[model samples]
Target: MLVRELLKNFQELANKEVEFTGRIRSNRQGKNVSFLVLNDGSVIDDVQVVYKNETKNFEQLSKQRLGAVVYIQGKLVPTPNRPQPFEIQAKISEIISECAEEYPLQKKEQSLEFLREIPQLRPRTKTFQAVFKIRSLLSFAIHKFFNEKDFVYVNTPIITENDAEGAGEAFVVTTRNDGKYEDDFFGKKANLTVSGQLNAEAYAQSLNSVYTFGPTFRAENSNTSRHAAEFWMIEPEVALNSLKENIDLIEELIKSVLSYVLENGRKELEACQNFFDDKLISRLESAKDSKFKVLDYAEAINILKEAVKKNKNEFEEKNIKFGLDLGSEHEKYLCEKHFGSPVFLINYPKEIKAFYMKLNDDKKTVAAVDLLVPGIGELVGGSQREDNFDKLILRSKELGINFDDLSWYFNLRKFGYYKSSGFGLGFERLVMYVTGATNIRDVISFPRTPNNLLF
Candidate 1:
């Protein structure tokens, strides 16, 4: 039986015979008695097994090393006054596989940085086990949220000829030893997709509401804690939705997922709280319960400028102006210090945003929005797409984007295309925010960063 099931039904299964097969997390033994903490990875907590010298292979069981796989036939005994609710009194015990003495994960506490070196075995640790379990639950909650809202899930292509973001950060896809493009596999230049928004938009025109949850690649050489070379994105496109409606949907989705994790992942959250961040649960609750503050880009710039005026060294980038792009420091200050909750900054300058965003009436700013949370700076980014073909072409030309490459995307505007809105949420960043994991590498199973690609 799994530790989660055994613990959940301990009240009814007390004093009943049960069999458990799992890895040994900790082994404490005396001459007569041996205690083994076993974990099967179903949950963060482990089951404790107490065995006396009467059991078979008693000497081997007593000397069993950590990380050894063991099977135990035992009876659950209730311990009301102890920290754990119940303990297993082992009647029969055997080592399924003995661990080598060179196991790296000793009983001593290790740093998160040190654990990153062994991605293959770090999941056995309680910290990563909790983080990954919460990640899995959050992923399921995302699908549930969109499915209940009648959004059709679309699997976008991994390789495409067009760059959706036009940021020139796409990883090139080629199967040629020589540097010839025309003789390549696709017959033309192809690259791994950076965002699935363009493809999801094409489906939204027909399905009304569609979402794409898949892996996207970026070729940037960033080694920050928040950036990763390969990551998963959750992009959802809705037809006929304005910027305001898009922001509302983002808010609803965030709150719904937060509530789901808070309710369903209580044990994992408790484990995270005890180890990583103490304010993890309360911070998530605050975000779910509070109404997200909506501040205009102009007003936010002014707020930053006023703060800068009060203190010269308020921000590292010192220049808080109208058209300047908001950095991580600026974003964190706005949400963490100014609002103390999630803040949605809207109507950014057209120069800083993508060419696909809808131009507002002022013609200087686009109808774009960025949702900034407390610890993590920007959690979600979205905007209302420009519906006019002429304006889109003009914007593309102004940004030096090739018109021939995206001719099919341009034709969407000509063929019964109306206003649509969508956003891209970085799955790793969301996991980091929810799990209180400081680094993006901690949340991902095998993170693909600039210089790290260990399995």
Candidate 2:
């Protein structure tokens, strides 16, 4: 019986003979009796088994190592005053796989760095067991939210010639037969996609609403806690949508998924809270209940400048001006310190934004917004796309992006271009925020960073 199932039907299974198989999490040998905790990865909590010296093979089973896998036949007995509500009285025990004495994950706390060295085995730890379970639930929650709203899930291409962000942070896709990439697989200079927005936009124009949830690659060399070479992105595009509508969609999606994880993933959440962050659940509850703030970029800049002058914070980059692109520290100050909740910083200067963002009436700034949260700085980045073909061509030229490479994308605007917008949310960052895991590496099962790719 699975631990989760046993817990759900404990009243029915009480005083009944049962059988189960699981790995031993802990073992203790006493003079008259012994205790063994078994975990089958069905849930966060393990099952407790008790056996005395008279039970079959009790001597060998009681001396099993921490990671030993076993099969057991037992009777469920209620323990009203014990830590666990019910305990298993063993009748027969079978060793499925005997563990060596060198198991790394013992009944002791281990540092995150030390566990990271053994990524393959880290899932057996309580911390990652909770983290990965929450991560999986969060992914399912995102798909459920989009599907319920009648959005078509589109799978975008992995390799492309166009860089949607236009920052040139792409991992070049190549097949080097003679020490150079002269023979490209796609017969062009191809690179992994930075965003799926451009492709999702074409589909959204026809389908009304569409979203792409897949892996995105970036070749940036920065080794920050938030930066990863390969990550998953969630991009949602909708035709005939305004910037305000886009913001509303984002807020709804965030709140919906957060509520789902908090309500349904109580076991995982409690485990994470007890181990990682004591206030993790309360923080998530606050985010779900509180109303997100909206502030203009100009006012945000002014507030940041005033904060610097008033000695509110010794900002690393103290010169917070109008045209300056805000960093993590500035975003944290606005969302965490200033507004004390999630805030949408809107209408940034065109020079600091992408070329596809719609140019404002002033022609100086563009229609862009970034969602900033308390613990995590930027959770989502979105904008209203430029629908005018002539303006788009001019903007691309102004940014020095080759027109030939993006001519295919421009064709969509040429035929029937309507106002459309979308946003990209980093999947790993979302996992980090929900799990209260401080480092990005802790959230992902296998992290890809600069000069680091382990199998």
Candidate 3:
């Protein structure tokens, strides 16, 4: 039976016979009766079992190891004197699976770094339970938001012939022996795609409205908390949209996702309130109703310059000029210190951004936006694409990208191009923002970090 069903029956079935099979959380003693907290991994709290009389096994059941699984036949009775509503008076208790006493997860709190060593068992902890619950809720919210808006869910290829980001940050796929290298499928090289923007663009033009929510691989070896080699991204592309409309869609998409999680995952949020900043739900709720502050790269540069002039920055930002990629410190200053929340930095330098971004009339900047939040510096990167085929080809050639392989992408423009926009939001980063878990490694069930591929 589901734990929820068991909970609903707790009051109605009080003083009645009950049977349950679950894992034991803790076993201890009282004056006469022994207590055991049991859970099936379905609910956050455990069902308390009280053992009063039996054979030598009754004492043994009371002393069962922490991670041991057990079964019990008992009577449910109201505990008016206790904190919880009910407790199970067990007539017989049977041990199922006996675990070694050296289980890593003691009842005490373990550091996140220690949990990283045992990724397989980390999800069993209270903190990870909350993180994953929020993650699941946000995922459903993404699908629901797009589904309601009449957007088609498109599955773009994981292995592809094109490097859509044009930054050469993809992990090449190969099936070769130690002595030599073999060709990829169709005798052409392939790699895990860094972004599905190019593929999603084709589908968006045909499907009119589409989004791709899937794993995107990047070979960027930056070992920051936000940078994961393999991360899930949510990219939504829409046809016949201006930059302002695209920004509006982004704002709405983020707000809707956060709102869904806050509304539906309240229990998990309460469990995780200690790990994050004090006002997580309030922050998300505020964001839902609050308008995002927008600033251009040039304006942000001026803000940074003024900070430098006044010696307000914590460290020297010698190279942080107009066109430089905003460092983590700079991004934090813009969103946390100055703007005080999530802020959008728009119209970045064309040379620094991806190739597909549309070049503005100034010819030096692209219509791009990077969503910067308080803790997670860069949660999203997206932009409107260049609709003009000639401009796209010129940009690609100038950037030394092989345009011949991207014929289908170019063909989208050939068949009458329309202005469209898309962006990529890191799934783990969003989880960090919601759960207040500081590390990305803790949010994922099995985190895949560089040189550390443990089960």
Best by lDDT: 1
With a 3 Å backbone cut-off (N, CA, C), the pairs that clash in candidate 2 are: none
Whole-model lDDT per candidate? 0.93, 0.90, 0.83
Residue-level error in angstroms, candidate 3, position 452 = 1.2
lDDT of 1 by residue, 285-401 (tens): 999999999999999999999989999898999988999999999999999998899999999999999999999999999999999998899999999999999999999999999
**Of 1 and 2, which scores higher on TM-score?**
1
Could you tell me the TM-score of candidate 2? 0.97
Q: For candidate 2, lDDT tens digit of each residue in 84-149? A: 889899989988999998889988898999998889988987779999999999999999999999
Which residue pairs come into collision in candidate 1? Answer: none
lDDT of 1: 0.93
Q: Which window of 10 residues has the lowest lDDT sum in candidate 3?
A: 177-186
Ranking by lDDT: 1, 2, 3
Give the Å shift of residue 134 in candidate 1: 0.6
Error of 1 at 61 (Å): 0.5
| Segments in model 1 whose C-alpha atoms lie over 4 Å from true places | none
lDDT of 3 by residue, 296-409 (tens): 999999888877777755545655687788788899888888888889999999989887899999999999999898877788888898999999999989999886788888
lDDT of 1 at 344: 98
